[model samples]
Target chain A: MAELDLDSADGRREALRRMVTIRAFDQEAGNRFADGEIPGFVHLYIGEEAVGVGTCASLESDDYIASTHRGHGHCIAKGLDPKYMMAELYGKAEGYCNGKGGSMHIADVDAGMLGANGIVGAGPPLATGAALSIDYQDRDQVAVGFLGDGAVAQGQVHEAINLASTWDLPAIFVVENNHYGEGTPVEKQHNLDNLSDTAQAYDIPGVTVDGMDITAVAEAVAEARERARAGDGPTMVEAQTYRYRGHYEGDEEPYRDDEEVERWRDQDPIESFKDRLIERGELTQEEFDDLRAEIEASIDDAVEYAQETDAPEPSAAYEDMFVEQPPELERFANVARTDGGANGGDHR
Target chain B: MTAQAELEQETETMTVREAIRQGLREELERDEDVYLIGEDVGVFGGVLEVTGGLYEEFGEERVRDTPISEAGFMGAATGAAATGTRPVVELMFSDFMGVSMEQIMNQMAKMHYMFGGKAELPVTVRTTEGGGMGAASQHSGTVHTWIAHFPGLKAVAPGTAASAKGLTKAAIRSNDPVFVFENKMIYEQSGEVPTDEDYTVPIGEAAVEREGEDVTVVATQRLVGESLGVADSLEGDVSVEVIDPRSLYPLDTDTIVESVEKTGRLVVADESPLSYGTHAEIATRVQEEAFFSLDAPIQRVGTPDTHMPFSPPLEQEVLPGDDDVRAAIERIA
Candidate 1:
C-alpha cells in the first residue's frame, strides 16, 4: 500500500476534488429524492464532507473503514465509484448491493469500504473486528470506523473501543460530530461536551479537531493511524462538524432553527477548502472551477447511469441469502421463479 | 475397504465435549485464519470445560479469552469474519444471546444479504442450551428454536458424539454464519466419533437414529437420545422410529417427510416450549408435505410454555424426557 501523501500538492488537489465530488453527488441525490426519482429517504453528507475526506486521506489503499448511515461522503472518500453508489441509491442491479441495499447500506468490501450501516453505533464494533482480523492475519493495515455524534451515547460503540484498546488492534475511531444525532442536539444526547473524552475511559489518546478544515482532520487521523500501526491500539478523534441539510431529505427539522443551519452554511467545508488551496498557491481559481466542472459532469454521468440501469429481477431476492442457498428456501424460490399463480402460487 | 467402512473402522469413543474440542483443534490446525474467542475459553479451558486443554495446545493467540462483553466480541467476530477469518465465538450460555442480539440479528445474520452478497461471514457461534443439571431457567433454557427460526443463520443441535464432532467441524468450515447449539447435559454422554479430521456432517441433513413402521419421533438435542431410548423400549408394541433433524433451519424435510410417510403417525419432540417453537415448525413442515400420510393427529413432546424452576422436582417435572416421548407416541401411534 502506498503512503497517503496529503502534504503534496497533487494529494491536496485530489482531496479537495473528492470533497467537491461528495458535495455534488449528494446535492444531486437530494434533488433526485425531492423529485421522487429516487425511492427512499437520503441523508445528505453535503456539509460534513471534510470529516470523511480528511480522515480517509490518512488511510492506505488496503486499510478498512466501516461507515454510518450518512455514508456517501465516506464511500467517495474511500474510492468507491460514484456510478455504482448512485445505482445502488436508485435501486438498480448495477448498484453496489444489487438493489438490495439502498442509500443506507451501500458497501464495497473489495474496495475496503465495509459498509454504510443503517443501525447506529454498529460500525465501530465491525471496524474493531476488522482490526482483529488484521492483527490475526499479521497485516500492516489499520481499520477506521466513522460514527455520528448520536452514536457516542451507544453502549456498543464504547464496547468496540474498549475491545480494540485492550487487544491493541490497529483501529482508529473518527467521531463525526455533526451536532445533531438525527434531530436531537449533541448536548442533550451526551453528558460530556467533547465526545473524544469518552476515549479516556479506555486509556487511549483522544483529541478533538476542526472537522470543517480538511487539513486539521487529515493531520489528526494520520497521527492516530500512525499510533494504531505502531501497536499503540485505538484512538478517538472527534471532528466538530455540522450538517447543513436536514437530517433526512424530507425532514421538517422542527428540532433546530434556520439560524443554526445558516450559521453552519457560512463555514461551508468545500468553499473554505477551495479558498485555502487558492491562497496556498496549490490551486488557481480557474483550476478550481475546472475541477468543479469535471466533478459536476461525473456526478451527472453517475445519475444518468443509475437512471439507465435495470432493476433486479424478482427471483434475485432468494439469491445471496447464503453461500450455498438452503433447501428450505428452495420451496419459496420455486414460487418466486414461477411467472404467475399457476404452479402452487397464491398460497398466501 | 470402502471409504465409508474405512472411516468407520477408525472411530474413537469420546464424550460430546471431547468431540467438539477435537473438531475445534482440527480446524485451528487446518486453517491459520480460524481462532477461538469467548469467555473462559482460554486459560480456564472454557466455562463448562468443553474447550479443556485447547488453550494449552493452541496458545493464547488462537485460543483467546475475552471480557464478558457479548455484544462487543460478537460484533467484532462478525467484522473479523467479513474481513477474512473464521471466528468460532462462544457465548458461554445461549441466554447471553440477548446481550448481543443487535450484532447477531442486525450485523452477523444480515451482512451477506444486506450487502448484496459482497460480504461473506464465516463465523460460527457455539453456545450451550437445555435443562438437566439444575442450572435453572436462564442457563438451561432450550433456545435453539430461536436461532433456527432466525433468518440468515444455520443452526445444528447434535444428538450424538459423532454428529457433535461432525456438525462442529461443518459449522466452522461453512462460509456462512452458523450456530452449533450444544445441550449442556450431553457433554458427558459418550459415543463413537469418526477419527478422520476432514469428516463433517453436512448441514440441513437428518440422521435416522432408529427405523420403525408404527410412529416417527422427530427430535433434537437431548430429546434425540431420549426419543431413541423410547424407541428401543417400545420396539415391539409401538415400533417407534427416531429421526434426529440435527440442522434445524435448512432442515432435511425430505428425510423427515419420508419417515412420517412410512410411519403414518408423527411425534415431534424437542426440549423447547410446545407452542410457537421448534416443535411447531417441524409439525407444520411435516403436515404440509405429508398431510395425507398421517393416519392420526400429530403429537408434540416438549416443555410446557414456562421457565425451568430452581427446585429439582419442579425442574425435572417441567423438563421433557423419554416418558414424554413415549406418551406422545402412544397418543398418535
Candidate 2:
C-alpha cells in the first residue's frame, strides 16, 4: 500500500472541506426533516462525517458502497449531487430515485451508491454481492459496506463475512462504533468491548482507528482498498466515533451525561481539521471564510432547487410495481371492481 | 395414432429430470451470463443428479458448489442478481428454506420494491419438493404452499417433462425472484418434451392437462400427476377436467374459476398437508368466484395435516396419492 500524504497542506485542506460539507448537509437535512419539508424518517450523519469522507476518499466512481440509514455523508462522499439528494428527501420528482425512495432509501447507481438500507446488517450481504459482480466482470472495483456497532449483532452480517472470506471477495466492512445503538450504549448491548474482535473470527485483518481524525481514517481505508484490489479478500476496520445528536431528531438526552456530549463536541472532526490546516499555515483565515461561503451557497442552491421541484405524479405509485404485469392481474382488477373501484376504493 | 406420429414420439422419449438437465445445458450454452450455484451442484451432481455433468461443462466458476450455509449463498445470489448476473441457486431441498428465509423473503423478494423499482432481481432458486421419495419428514416436506403465500415471490411446480423444461427456462428469464419446485418422485417420469432449445412455458398460466365437463380438478406440483392419473381412471364414468397451475403466487385463479364455472363443481388435489395448503386457497378462491355456478361444495384432496412418516404404509396414508385424488373426484362428480 502507498503511504498516505496526510501531512500535505492540500490533503489537510480537502479534509476540512469534506467535514464542512457533511456538517452543513446534515444540519440542513435535520431542519428540513423536522419542518416536514422532507418526508420519511431521516437519520442524520452529523457527528460521524469523518468516517464516510475519509473512507470514501479512497474510492472511485466505479467502486460500490452500501450505506446505513445515516447516509447523507456517504452520498456526498460518493459524489451524489446535494441538490438531487435534497430533492429526494423532499420527495420531489427530480430526486435521485424519482421521489419513490425518501431519505432512508436515496441511491444513485451511476455513482455506485447502492441505496441506504432500512434493515440493519443488510448492507454487508449486498456489498458482498457487488464484490462478486466485480470479480465476475473482471473489474478492479471493490465494494464497501458501512454499518453501526448496533448492526454487528445481526446474523446476516456474520453470514456476509463468512461468504466474503470463503470466496475471497474484494470487499471492506467498516463499523462506525458511535457508542450507541439508538440511545443504548455498546456496553449494554454487546459482550465484547472492541468490535474489531468480530472481524478476526473471519480470519481477516482488523484495525481500529480514531474516527475524529480524518487523516487516520483515510490512511486505514486506503490500505484496505489496496489489499482488496490485490485480491487479498476482505478487511474489517472499526472507527471509534461519537454521535453528537440524539438517536433521531426529537429524543431527550436521557441516555448520557451532558458533560460527555460536550467533551465529544469539543473534539469535532471539522474543527480539528481546520485547526491543523491553520497551524501548518496551509490555509489562511480569508481562504477558510471563502470556502465556507462557497459551500453555504451550494447548500442554499440545493435547498432552493429541492423546494422548486415537483412531487411525483400519483400514477407513479401504480407504475413499476412489477417488471411485467401478469395476465392474472385482470383477476385482481375484477376483484377490485366488485369491491367498488380498481384500487379497492383507496386509489390515493 | 398415425404411424408417423408414433415414430416422432419414440424419438422424444425422455424423463422429466433428463428434460430439465437438457434445458439447463441449452440455457448455459446460449447465455454466458447464466451460472449455477448450490450445494453438491458440481461433482456431486446435485443430490438428484438434475445438474449432472454441468460442472464438467461450465467449470468451477459457473457451476460453483457452495457451503451448506443457504443464507450466505442465497444472499450472494441476490447480490449477484443486482449486479446484472443471472444466478440459478439450488436450495437442495424445499424444507431447507428456513435457513435462508430472510434472503428469500426480505431481500430477494423485496429488493425491486424496496429499491423503488430501480433494479430487477433475475435470480432463480430451484429445489426438490413433496413426499413419495421416502426421504421422510425432514427432507420430503412439500413447502411450495408456504412460499406461494409470499407476495413478491413467484412459485412454480411443473408436472410433465415438457412443462418442466419450458417452465424452468421461463423462471430463469423472469426478472423477479422465482422459486422453481421440482417433485423428487417425478424426476424419472417420462413424457414428450419439446426439443427446441428456446422453448418456454409462461409463468402464472394454468395448463388444461385433461378436458372434461362434470368437475374441475385443480392441482399443482406433484399432485398434477396424481390428478391426471385420477382423470384417466375416471374417463368412462366421470369426466374429470384437470387444471395444472404451474406458478402459484401469481396464481391463475381465473382459469380455475372458469373451469369450475363450466363444470359446476371443483376439487383441488395438493401433495402438501391439508390444513392451510394451496389446495385450500384454490378451493376457497374457486368457490368465491364461481359460487352461483357450483352444483356442489368445493372439496380438497390432500395429505392429512401431519408430518410425513418414514414408514412406507404410514407415508402412503399421510400423502395424497392417485387413489385419494380419484376418490375426491368421484365424490365431487
Please write out the lDDT profile of model 2 over residues A169-247, one tens digit for every residue.
8999999999999888999889997898887799998899999888778888888888988999999999999988887
Task: Work out the TM-score per prediction.
Answer: 0.97, 0.92
lDDT of each: 0.90, 0.82
Candidate 2: residue A98 Cα off by (Å): 2.9
lDDT per residue (tens digit) for residues A1-348 in model 1: 333467788888889889999999999999999999999789999999999999889899889999999999999999999999999999999999999989999999999999999999999999999999999988989999999999988989988999999999999999999999999999899889798998999999999999999989999999999999999999999999999888999888999998888898888888998898889988899999998999999999999999998999987888898998897676866656545332242243
True contacts kept of each: 0.77, 0.42
- Docking class for model 1 is medium
What DockQ does predicted model 1 obtain? 0.64
Off-target runs (Cα >4 Å) in candidate 1 are: A1-4, A336-348, B1-7
B118, model 1: CA deviation in Å?
Answer: 1.0
lDDT of 2 by residue, B1-333 (tens): 111232243337699899889878888888877889899999998999999999998898889888787887888888778877889999999889998888788777766765567778888899998887688898988888877887577888988787788789988888888889998999988888777777777887778888889988888767787787878878889898888887787788777878888999888887888887788788767656666788997888877888888899988888887887787777767
* Per-residue lDDT value at B330 in model 2: 71
Interface RMSD in Å per candidate, to 1 decimal? 2.6, 4.2
Residues B190-230 of candidate 1 have per-residue lDDT tens digits of 98889988888989888888778999888888888888888
